[model samples]
Target chain A: MNISLQTRLLLLMSVALAIGVLVTQQAGRYESRRTAAADIDARLGRVAHTLLLSWQVSNDLTVASIPALTVAPPAPDGKRLPVFEVTTFDNRVLLRSHDFPLRTHALRAAGPGYGNAEIENTRWRVFTVIDSQRRIICRVALNEHDRSLREATLAPHFDQPLLLGVPLILVLGWMSLVYGLRPLRRLSRELARRDATDLAPIRSVDNDAIVEIRALRRTLDGLFERLRHAVNAQRLFTAAAGHELRTPLAGLRTQIEVAQRAPDAQQQTHALERIARAGEHMEKLVSRLLHLARLDSGETEIARHTLDFAALVARISGDYARVACDGVDRPAELQGDASLLEALVTNLLDNACRHAPTDTPVEVTLAHHDHWLTLHVRDHGPGLPEADRARAFDVFYRGENTFGEGSGLGLALVRAIARAHGGHAGIDPPSRDGLCVTVRLPAAHRS
Target chain B: MRILLIEDDPILGDGLQVGLQQAGYSVDWLADGALAADALANDEFDAVILDLALPSRSGRQLLADWRDAGQTVPILVLTAYDALDDRIDGLDGGADDYLVKPVALEELAARLRALVRRSQGQADNCLRWDGIEFNRASGILSIDGQVLDLSAHERQIITALLERPGQTLTREQLASRLYGWDGGPESNSLEVHIHNLRRKLGRQRIKTVRGLGYRMAQPDR
Candidate 1:
């Protein structure tokens, strides 16, 4: 059940207390009652022996049959004392105690053992024994009302302490637990007081913190530290992105202003040409940013479709001159998103065209082997240095000699599109001075 | 006036240089921070337009180095970082002024003129002699109350002469002021400009030295 720890503990302790008290109470009552009853029976046997001795003495001395004396009634104050009787063998009553107006066969029924009898509507426990030497019988009895195992003395002693201890133990247990859990409560309160932007580490409230509490605090501190780093990194990245975007914007504005205030037609034309270049640069930057954003955000699902890979490459490479497509006539089919695939081929061609020398031709090679399709785009331009080969696919990483209009996102987007189709892209050194990129995709036949 | 433009971006640098040059200030461009620092140490510029992020070194480092060396040339920081912390740091680290990118060319020119004037301790932004008035901010030349139209080359030459009315300047010095580190027409062009100026202004206003180039005549008190 969804219960608090304190309440749950209290509930379990209370149930244990109830069972403990019940067992002890019942066992005590049973033991005490049996002991009291046995004690009462022993006293009755002693009294019977005493009475027989006294009667035997009186009968042997023949002292006028004990002078027919009458014992005084029991001591006052409504106590039903034990009663006794003496009788001869012929069923004659010699003496009796607890005097009653009428007696009916009290000494004649039981032979020589303890028995129960009703005399004047009062039940009695009778211990009857025969005195052979005195030729008489002696019987001592106690009424059921005078039984020792009543609910008076032991009830208060046994039940009162346990009943009172319930509240005491509950309150004390609850208080001690609250003290032990103080650190946890303090931590929660401190967390609740923090603002959303506050990622500071939580501090220890005391010098002697428990190990569990200390461990919890350490975990929380670690999380907050990571969050702080992430936030700072995001802020820095946004600032960098803003700076990159604004530089081109500033260029475009300055060029437009220059054109507007040009002194002559030739100067105006020069400014306009720069302005057009600035526009092109801005367009490339923005489109690259959008592509990266879309890829990161997972907004565009990679819709799988079967298409001719060779045909796609040929169609995209049609824009660039001196592009020789080898092994591209066959219908090399693969399952991937059409639009994303189109973008992928276009970016590969764009990178090749930008890097390749004007007169040299860009080479496109597409081939399929075993359940995989491989495509290569090669350019005979200044090959990238080995040091820059690894990070060349990083977004916005422009090479040292790179100029305006190179957004530096072409290879990065190509790799992203290639990976979305359960494929990989990598760079390979060409035979001579050029950059050759290779992409591998799972062919449709694999399925 | 002349300006040194230190920017890493090719398109922005080329455009800003052209705009500033067209506004009648000779502009020299540097694309690397180390080269910029070296040029500032050797040559003279009326003002400097610095981009904060650059290759070889950062603009802030150069600014600190220049300020530490007690160079009093006015520096205007032009950068794409619009953050408050960046601005505060740039200004507090010895920059004469700070501006975010995408600034209007006219505003940039005006700020540069103001920076130059302030460094020269000219409060009214005007230097007057021989009944001729020049406003640095507008690059406007007027005589007394009437405005006078002059070509860009003539305006530059006369403005330089007006700043130092009693000092004679050589032809190379004047040409260097009009075109910094870049080729201009030959020395005879200076004489043609001087001829054009003498035609517009009185002959006595521009005194031609035999060996030295030219000087504005000291007005009679």
Candidate 2:
């Protein structure tokens, strides 16, 4: 069941050639039989003519009655011979060969041309003719077994070619296939030799490869390139996440030390406040890091369903008092993964609320345009500078003047989830001092 | 002693500044590397505590630049990158000492004291004189067999003098060590602390030259 390509191809070709040889063998047998039949008819008619001529020279019925004059004798045995019977119009027998049937009317059903009848336990091809000038009827026949001997002669022509050519062609085909697949074998060997951490692009063993093999090499190289990039990205993310945690951890340690050495309740209370804030920030960072890591693993399936976008955003908005949902009352439906879409909305809203002014509310709007649904979230805080906006979607990329305690993963997760749903996320720099993020998804509502 | 604290994290920087100040140091904290480099060049500090990752500039780059400029202050690298390569590169790039993050306050203080002491040509954290013993780590001064209580200024004066046993320090240099750039007692108030140290450690312990500064008295021949 797990046959290699070479063996499979060889087996298929061998079967096809065998069938072809069998069909050709049948055709050869049929043609040999036909040709033998035709030859037998001609020979029988010639023998009958010769007998008539020999009889005409004598003009004596007794002389023509000689069995040797009638036909050649059976060779070495009675297995084969040309047998005949000369009869008058009144059904009187004039001459009968030794091999002629004893029973009367045994071959009478035979027509004048050529026909077959059994005589003396041997099937015969019979040719009968009436010599009008001689006032006699001549009947000639030879055993049908002779045609089989002729059939044997054709074996050398048909059987030899098939017997020899099949194996030869098969061998040639096998050799060509092996030669063609050599490049693939080399490619697999090269791949098998590599260590897991080696993401270097593979060099095909030879440049004499076919088009398909070359294409396969290019695809494998491209895949390795992508794997290398993903590995590097993972390394950088781990490093950033670890570095980001150090300060908070350091803050916790120093705060505890300060509290332990506090001289008064006031000093202790202040240290405790900083410790509480730092602990909360660390918790936020760790949870966001988990989300980013899961997304990076590329295993999360986007479970698609027809869900109302307006209700989902409204639900996420209601969780935070500072976020307001706009144009989400009636219903706007789209086909998307429910959980992933919810996360995308939540991240956008969280990002907006984090950066928004303390007094102002974050705004969310959903709009549908031709097969596309766009969601926009705006904040009235000091907008991201022109420089920091481009790399906002990069993991762990934060502006120097970023707002308080944003894990820098919120916008990155937003972009990731949106892209997972066959969409894109972008930024629109507002004229006023604010930032707005927009996400677009394909619209597939119910008919 | 005065210290320059260069770190970018808000809470960590705040905590370190407070902790070092509590350890009897005047700490000048800067959150940016470019600003820190400028401050280091234009000012003086007994030692420096630097974070490797900083905005606008990196601590390693600043260290290399400072070393290239022949700035001779002791620098202690405090970073979260615990890789051996990062440590090697930081040290080879002219850092006087290196430490990983989440360090204990006591350890940081001890290392800072050691760096500062070694940079000043003192062998260790302890300074010995004629019948007087000064311990930097414990911040305690003892004469013969008795512990002598001293004010913060008196301690600063004795520490500066003990580090440079025979060398003299100008009034401004001593004031900078005690109070960094912004605050200290009035200009002439340094003499008061010097006089008090001389009294506490015995008059033979400190000598003052006219129109110059103060130095620890050499041991009697």
Candidate 3:
């Protein structure tokens, strides 16, 4: 059962209060009983003492044999009074009368003492005493059926407090609990009335409670902030993807129209070539978009392994030499995931190749420092404006005069991969001839 | 022009077939890439309109196979997805052109004409006639050293007519050339534009094919 927090909290508090009140009530009842028994025993012993001082025990109702003179007349029916055995001071039973069972042997068992006892099957209390000089043992017993009447006589002593004070204590205890938890109730009401988006801390006069509420509010606010950021990023990506796809679609239409009007074989071939180029542009854009989406969705679980940085760079450069050999000169070097690195180097070199004059040289160099590996691609092309350098890495970012069709996710993907690998990518200061870009990867030890 | 159209969707294929027939091209339609490839191997087609998502074998793969086998017939790839990466991949696999779905019939016909023109290596210039000639790229019309500078749109209209010299082009077709799907001219705009062109180029330069459309004539200067 998924118990709500409020219900659980209330139940816990209620259980604690009940246990506390019950224990206190049990203790108070036990203490009152002890005090009452002690008082009854004391009074019975006093009566026995008075009888011993004034008269002697006899087998007749002389002035000394009067019930009040004879050990309080065996507790006077319903009142608990001393019970005694009168003999020739030899501890023999002189008289034995009782409202409840008063054990005469209690005098012998007590060795000339008195105490209180309860009768088994009857609601009674008994106190016994002995007087050796009077040759009498006295016991006081009382029926609890008339307890209220007897307690009325002792009301001035302990009755008022015991009878009236217990319920008052319980009522006061309940009020005290309610007062102590007032701050908690206030916090609950404040939270209950709040909207889901309301992250403000509940105001409280109690410092400790306020601090806890503030901490909770901070955590919730932080989570909402992160959620907003993620949603914004998704929106930006989708808009950029749409714009990137539009240009190629427009280009395709133009290519097809040119091909349709081709009157001869040669014109048709030229028109076909333009269409092919447009198609090639479309393919790369789709793949790049999918790649970015995969990375953004955190679905890229890149396999990690030991890599030879120099070897990887040489291999990529060798592969690029086949494609880029016709133009400029040497191929670009790169070191990273063979597939991902190929895409990275391809995009960079391709960007340079499209923008730079065919005669200008594009150079790539890889260098390793203390704990970093940096790959630099230099192109003798019109470099990006210093102002546009930052915006260059944004998805679908296109420069002013880039010639061939491009998706514009090349640098964005490169940036994402760099961050994923705990590295960084950025544009460097251009040489007099053209632009330069440097990508730095943390060495294995640093990583 | 004999064109092979490999489209899987029956509605689009039927529409394209009827449209191409109306536009004066012989169109052979196939629903499967494999059958299209087979037909291409056995028969001669001036051009091929290949849908990328064809049954049996994908259009891209068919184009690749045909190109690998040295088939030089112009292949125009058609697809629903207009993604750049998909376009690039299609072209890279040897498709001559890529077009998206829901294309206008006139636009498709124009594209086929362009593709055929490109395959012939014809530049966008040099329209020849009886002793008079028009150069579209340079916007110049020459008749025995009398050079006339024509506006770009006039040159485009003349060049379009010169593509099929004596063939009729409806007013709607002329309007399509002037304005794309968006921002078309107002009513009777094509006639007004043609009248202005005829007055500048001389009345005999163009002929109105009755009940058909307009056409450029080989003038007997």
Candidate 4:
């Protein structure tokens, strides 16, 4: 399940809001219940005190049948209205002023103070007082409806402020969250609507909130830069290849044309020779292109094995001896890909053969020191100019004196392969009378 | 010389046939690798010019087959793919030489001659004509016991021209042979050198073929 960023963030905010609201409601409810309990207890204490005062004043009224004391008529609207049965201290019911429901559960046996008890599914707060002079106990009790513990605890939460305000607060919280997240939402929408090539930075109103977004934009920009570079490199390579190819192709065509216009055997034969030379040039160019492409794309895997460099050089020397006026030195043994190494060696040897005088013998030497393998091919031919030396490593940067049928990617490809194997190629000043090329490879096997 | 031309393109094959026959070689051309292979099996030819791309078998494969069958006739492989690997592969597969497409006929015959001579392992390195014996090994010119004082570059150029006497040498060929790689005579350099050599020897010794190149003509009797 892949969740989008918005959905995950919204869910997190919603859960946090819900928990906050519920916790506030629960806390408010608990505080209200505590205050209500305290209110009821205080009211019971006051009622008990009032009843004790009334009993003390009645202590002198015991003569002549107690002269039916006219108790003040109950004022039903008064705040202090009391409802209770009067009883004697000696456990005798004196007067039942009102037939109170739940009379047996009233304050009759309660000792001069407030008490609580449940009677018939209802709870009551009862108060009792004792007058020693009159020897009477007066008790007062009230139905615990309005001032009841459960109602006092539960009522206010349903009243105007809390009941209405909680929902209002929750709605406000949600709206605020939505407003706060607008920038992120806009960024996402803008990103979604863009094409693959549009790698511009996101426009944001709140700069403080989008540090990560800026970092992400930087990363994307880097990727785009690299992609553009790769595309440019490929374009340049193709254009160079095409341009280089035209020379040989044109030569081949002109050779054929020349032959077609030839009036005699001698002329035709000469044209044919030129055509053959052009063909050879084309062949060299093509092979170099393939080798360079293979190296660049990493398509060529190394077949590494312990190679007897001496034997390989000897074989190459023997092969080229008929045409090579220059002699190649014996090579040393090392571990490397035989085919790639052969290419490297052959290219250098062939280059020397092409440049040197027919009578001059090129010298080749191979040696190993520590973990490094080195091979040197030197031609007594004119050495590369110092100015052109660096450019010589660049593809197609043929020297001014180089007139051979070559692709000019020889040294470039050799360098690429050597670098890939954690080695390097260099042009050393000739110890003798020619230009020398040095190839060095690290001893470690690089796959 | 009898030549077997193996090429796929009819226009190129036809052009080559006309050009080669005009150059005095008896030409037998095959349009595909299969036909070339079949012809090679059924008939004997002095030399074979094979094209790399063919219908059934490629020129490289055909050359390999011929060599494997112990055919000692020199095979020159022609290809449109002018890559180094292609050239090396063609050569490695038993081709005596490799050539790119759109070649001139005269150069082709000269190369054929060289290949034939190489195959026969001829000892003489000199082409003798007009009382001049050009020693290819020593890079010296001797005419009736008189040694020509030629510059190294001039000697190399005259030697190449002398190798194929009476034939036009393209500017590209002369430049490549003289300058080591085709750096070409920079700023009328080849013309200047040729002029100097002509003054030393004789103007009639080397003739210029207009718009084509320089050629060492046979003795004008």
Candidate 5:
């Protein structure tokens, strides 16, 4: 499933905290048990010393009334108590406690130390003390089970902190997660409440402590800014296009109305001529609009094939041979979309025809050097100023002081078509009293 | 019929003027919305064909101003805004009818006729007086079962008289209907057309009151 970031972080923390609690609890138990056993052994050694001093003062080795040894009180439940034995070097037991378990084997006579023995199924901690001058041995042992019982009495003390700490950690972890994710939730809510057409940037909240979230908000704001500009540009273009289309349509309607009510053949012919011109203008506008839209959408699939660039130029030039002259230096070949290339050439020639003087001949030239194949179209028209050269290829941008009527989409479409073939188009610096537009493409490999 | 045309575009304004004039409407074209408003306040027109986009003042603003001033002239809105909301706005803004641009000239004329007829409390396309029936659409007059051929000027005079039968029409009113403000009446042009009209329909069909003007003679049912 898709777990949220907060849940994932909480889950990881919970697992780590669980392991910490378990390890701490076990170590507490082990250390407390060891310290308790050591404490018991020290108390037993002190008691044995007192008993030895009494025996030395009396100067008697025979069995007699033994002094009452002050021992630890019995387990609270009265199950077991501290036990002891006094024995000689010859394996004879001289003294013993009332509760000491009877054993069949003789107690091993050894140096004074601490050890463990199992008299029955129960285990015990044994401490031994010896008086070598008197040949007396004193051994004291306590039930291991009793020590565990005492440790258990202190169990709640250790457990209370852990029991309280674990839940506190979980609650604190969950609360922190909720608090930390507040900014993201606020951003989502803000986005959801906005209108579909509202392209305004999301306002960033001040005092956001998380750097990553702040960065994310900045990135989103940047994206929204770009989208708003694009949307505004598109809206302006559509509005302008609507106004442009209405002008021609209005003209066409007026001309047709005039034609319908013309009084004579001469007037009818004049009206018919205007109507035809308006229709042709509308047709050209519509076709250019379609081409520009296709290019803007970036979805036109280009079918590329290897074709002779010089021959293609020659063929295209033939269509405009009456007004345009061609110069093809050598046979240049290129791989590109044929229809798009033809459109590009046609748009260039048409643009020249519309702008250039009727007497001047438009020039078309093609040359290839190294991997680059270039096509150039020069027109003897009122060339664009240096500032307008860059913007002239923008959609619907008309040049200053241009001749004849045009849609203003031809040069833009030419640039788009050229770019689609992995090429570039630009206005070359004029070497004479004319304007030259050049398109450069990568030449196809001979193989 | 007199019409006030408020349009900014010169070509469209000229074309509409010509076409509407040919359709027998005396059109007073105004290129600016403020001028149109001023003219509307001072002049009497049967209907108005208003363009939404205009110079000096927008058409919508002028319409609002006119309606606020209690002008009840039937208005037909002409605009290039073909969206549904634009039509709704135009109608809700007190326009009697709405037409998108590039509308057929015949349709425009018909719509104007319908608007004028409705203003005059007319229900059908034919106006009848006695045995004569006038078809508003074709501008043709028929008596009994026979159609009468009439000149454009004679047709205008008969249409004006037939619109309100039994009511006396002043000579000035009849002259204004026959020729627009620009065309001055000749000394006996109205008399000539009236004579022609009376000769074609019987002389008893029209009665000239002693100094008032003319009225259609009512025939007994």
Candidate 6:
């Protein structure tokens, strides 16, 4: 919960190291016990072999007369001593040590093997060796409790390496983690040092960064580039708007002054007429600007409905009977926001009329193919250059050859409206002489 | 005085044309920058009023081009761009004077007059000859401290001749000044106006240079 990357990594490393240490310690304990038990068994087998050889050398002697064979010596500090015994194949004791725990029967009835036995309520590890030529079996045993106590005494000696190595492992793990995250820290510092307006991409190198960090840096750089473009566009839009609005306002002021200064009723009438025309231009400009602002803010709600595209174009073209006409008569229906569609058509028509020569008629064509309805508005005017086509839809971008008083938002608004209806707008290359702006939208199924 | 007005906006251009015409200056208006540039190259005018944002060519580019081409007609820039940088750019780009839009008609007229006077190497707005002082600002002529009422056509002829005193102005030049290139006066209208001017002021006050033109005669001391 709310843990930093470093802390989480360190915690995971510590837990893993602790488990490794525990497993190593447990394996060391088990191996040490096994090695000690194996050593005791080998020693007991050697003693049994030696006892059989001794008995063969002193054949025909009485058991009481045989020297007391000290098969295993006593402990130096008076601990319990190891026990040994020699027996015949028939299970009769032939020789035995003085401190042997069992005298009524041999340590084991079987011969030539090593195993565990219980004697006088204590457990012992016993080994037996047999001499077939002498018909004798010799056995030696050690207490299980004593062997376990010896193993316990030697545990810390084996654990000394583990005790010193665990902290070193943790330190190394933490260092690697810090070193790996250094790039991330640098990225954060760079972000923190930046001002709000600084949208420059972060510097990056190919070889120095790991893959993950490099990916992160690349994504952030992309974001910065997008933001910078958006900001520049916004700045351009505002400047263009200020320039556009002020010119008309200036016209209004100058026209009013002209009207006031008119020497005669005729001149006054002409000035007043110009004033009215300027007011209309300004009104159109303001409304278009407000529409663009709404689109930019993403605040306008679009209500979509199924409508006949061909019929809509035909009806709207009638409003500009002299300049516009629908080229097709078929029912090409589509689903879209109707008001926005009307605005789109109106802006296109207005743009064509404004740019084209007064006598040239604007052609509106509609076609349906593969669930798409395409609306094309073509004008017989000097079309935009290839270089200007790309930026024609950019807000307030008027081409160099363009001649008119325009708000420069007509094409941009058309594209915006088209996009809102899940469609797109583009300018086709001039085939002969003129511009053909095309809008493509999804066609509704016939019902 | 004849002035060339270059503005792109229809309403503003129309109003400036009417207002300047009423101010007693024969004005030729072009709404396209390229056309205005061509007109400036071909025609001679006392001054030019230019708008910056124009069709086909920007006014700034046209001004720079005209200056490069050694056209010395004084140009006054009238634009809606009032920012400091825009003003600096306009002035540095060979504009004679810069005025932001929403400009008063009187101010624009005064500035145009001043630009014209400065270009003609005159320090004041008064042109005097033969005891008649022409007030360029008021478009009025006063003799012996008494203002004389005159028709618009008579004012145009006197203003044109007074700008260059003692110089002969041909009938065609005076007729163009009075009624522009499109509408020249019909059936010796210039003679009729001259007849009326000779009737009002003393007949010898104007000299008829036969087969050449007319000039203002010197007054006796």
Top DockQ prediction, candidate number? 6
lDDT of each: 0.80, 0.81, 0.64, 0.68, 0.78, 0.82
Measured on C-alpha atoms, candidate 3 has an lDDT of 0.64
TM-score per model (chain B): 0.92, 0.89, 0.58, 0.56, 0.88, 0.92
lDDT tens per residue, model 5, A266-352: 767866776777778788788878877887788787778998878878887888754454556467888988877888888888888
Question: Residue A247 lDDT in model 5?
Answer: 53
lDDT ranking, high to low: 6, 2, 1, 5, 4, 3
Candidate 3, A325-349: lDDT as tens digits: 2221333233346566556667777
* Interface CA root-mean-square deviation for model 3: 14.3
lDDT string, candidate 4, A232-268, tens digits: 7887788678857755674567557758677888878
Kindly report which residue stretches of model 4 are placed more than 4 angstroms away from their true locations once superposed.
A1-12, A45-116, A123-209, A318-336, A351-362, A378-392, A399-403, A420-422, A426-436, A442-447, B1-221
TM-score of every candidate relative to the true structure = 0.73, 0.76, 0.52, 0.53, 0.65, 0.81
What is the CAPRI rating of model 6's predicted complex?
A: medium
* lDDT per residue (tens digit) for residues B1-221 in model 4: 45788865544565666566555445677765666787877664557888775654667778878888999988887666677988898888888988876566666877876785576565566667788877644457888879988776677567667656788888766765554222654858888889998887688888888899988865456
Candidate 1 lDDT, A1-447, residue by residue in tens: 798776777788779878887898887778667765676678789878877777656665443455444353554654444567777788677777635225647635766887777776777677889878768877777766676433344456666777788789878978987887777778888889999999998865682358888888888889999999988867765665677788889988998888888889998999899888888888877776777667755788778888988898888888777788998898899998888888888888878876765778989999999889999989887778899899888776655543224566788888888887889999996468788999999989745
Q: Model 3 reaches what TM-score against the true structure?
A: 0.52
**lDDT (tens digit, per residue) of candidate 1 on B143-204:** 77788778888888997888778799888878877888886867578788889988887677
Give DockQ for candidates 1 onward, in order: 0.45, 0.44, 0.02, 0.07, 0.12, 0.53
Which DockQ-derived CAPRI band holds candidate 2? acceptable
Residue pair clashes in candidate 5? none
i-RMSD of model 1 (Å, 1 decimal): 2.4
Q: Which candidate would rank higher by DockQ, 2 or 5? A: 2
lDDT of 3 by residue, B1-221 (tens): 56787875543565566456445555777876667778888765668998775545777788888999999999888776577898999888888788876576677777877787787576644667665677533457877668876654565577667767778887666654555233355877677768888887788878998888898786574
